[model samples]
Target: MTTNMTTKTLYLLCSAAPPVFDVAHVVEDAQARGWDVCLGLTPTAAHWLSGSLDGLAALTGHAVRWQYKLPGEPDVWPPADALLFAPATFNSVNAWALGLTDRFVVGVAAEAIGKGTPVVAMPCTNSAIAAHPQFDQSLAVLRTAGVELLYGESGFTPGPAGLDTPPHFPWQLALDAVDRHPTAQA
Candidate 1:
């Protein structure tokens, strides 16, 4: 499949959130919007989508990555023109803010801050998780680092705990954020 040279690359990262099950549709939406979408997942998220990995790769025309490349190994995905990490879980959000490099999705978002890559994140969490003080702190840290956070009323609002599914992940908001980002316009 041929890609337009002018198409911007979007690193669409997902964490172990319930909405992650719908990631394939999200990728297709991004593609329709003219993005060269590369999918990345947290370890658990990757495991959740294990059966669909190959189909996802075929759909995106790129490898679906959930781990860091080995030393001296060439990067499989192209450099991200912008990143949209939706359905980001509370743990992933905090880990990324704290500069924890343990999880591949969070690690890349963390490093992206320092690299000045435009990033937008929509965290999926319950009211219980959002109540944690550290969760707010992490959101602040990410905002300070220039990561556009889609949370609260503008993004994913936490519902009561123990739901089988989260409020619909605000993927469109993340995509809109990316479209509005200065780097994306350039």
Candidate 2:
């Protein structure tokens, strides 16, 4: 039987890094699939990925959010169907892993997880950081909490035995993951 599923909303949380190229493509793809996409960018990330937000907004038909709050206004939180953190920087990953939510992206992610929103994180970093013991522990914690970690290219590189590899990005993998999630259709 085929299921008629509609994407309600998707939150794209980004961090500052060159890997952000992957994120822009993913956001565009998500919008193409009829998902409402909102971008929550870290302060540093905003500077790097500034121009891309206009393109994202054009494609998604929604404004991207960077600061925690609008100028002189209270917080306005957007409801999201799924949260995808692409090119998740090492800093943000560590912060979220240890329950720190100082930044808007990490804070929103924490809130989403607390409310049972499905989360897909595409962590992009060097091999050394990816293989760090602390990073592994953080991944374990997130996994235990039901967060799906889409470890980036580093995870797929052939190396040690018994290592699992993640599929590539472009929001297709994220959409597939969401399709498998019980809440995505709801």
Candidate 3:
């Protein structure tokens, strides 16, 4: 199905991770579900998708934003009804929970929560990183603030540390969770 600009807007804030390269799949899937998707990447994720920026822009019909725009820069993207933080790194999660908004993705995610936007996050950290005390605390903080975190049983779990395979990044689950959020329907 072709999603037009009039559909509900979703700001997909992608962080750097192995799954960052597969963001096109999420965009297409979201579009198929009738969302007008806008992508906001962390600096690193933007670099990772640098070669495909034009393609991404064409697909979303909007520029993929990473850095903060100048004060007078005309905003081209539609207002977002929801924000999905996919491939969220451990750093981004922790930073966001602590109210750090230095990076565009983290900053936007933080602001979205404060604005009561329907927000969903899919963290892509390994068990080792997830085991950090701060990681658990961050998850707790976000969950307390009504952020839908796609982690543990409801989301992706880390694979064996030494395995050659990366844990499957559940891009679709993030969208599903967002759709299920009360704010989205409100």
Top candidate by lDDT = 1
Better candidate number, 1 or 3, judged by lDDT:
1
Please report how far candidate 1 places residue 87 from its true position, in Å. 0.9
Quick one: ranking by TM-score, best first? 1, 3, 2
RMSD of each: 1.3, 5.8, 1.9
lDDT of 3 by residue, 1-186 (tens): 234444588899988888888888889988877788899999998998899999999898888899988899987777789999988889999999999898988988898888889888988888887888999999999999988888889998877566444658777788888778665653
- Which lDDT value does model 2 have at 125? 62
Tell me the tens digit of each residue's lDDT in model 2 across 21-95: 566566656656656677788888888777776876665566667767758895443588888886677788889
List residue ranges in candidate 1 displaced over 4 A.
none
Instruction: Output the better candidate (1/2) by lDDT.
Output: 1
User: Number of clashes in every candidate structure?
Assistant: 0, 0, 0
What local lDDT does model 1 show for residue 78?
Answer: 83
1-186, model 1: which lDDT tens digit per residue?
216754688999999888999888888887777789899999999999999999999988999999998999998988899999988898999999888888888888888888899999998999997999999999999999998888988888899989979757777778888989877764
TM-score for each prediction? 0.96, 0.79, 0.92
Model 3, C-alpha of 46: deviation from truth (Å): 0.9
Local distance difference test, per candidate? 0.88, 0.70, 0.85
Which stretches of candidate 2 lie above 4 Å from their native place?
A: 1-7, 70-77, 152-171
Best by TM-score: 1
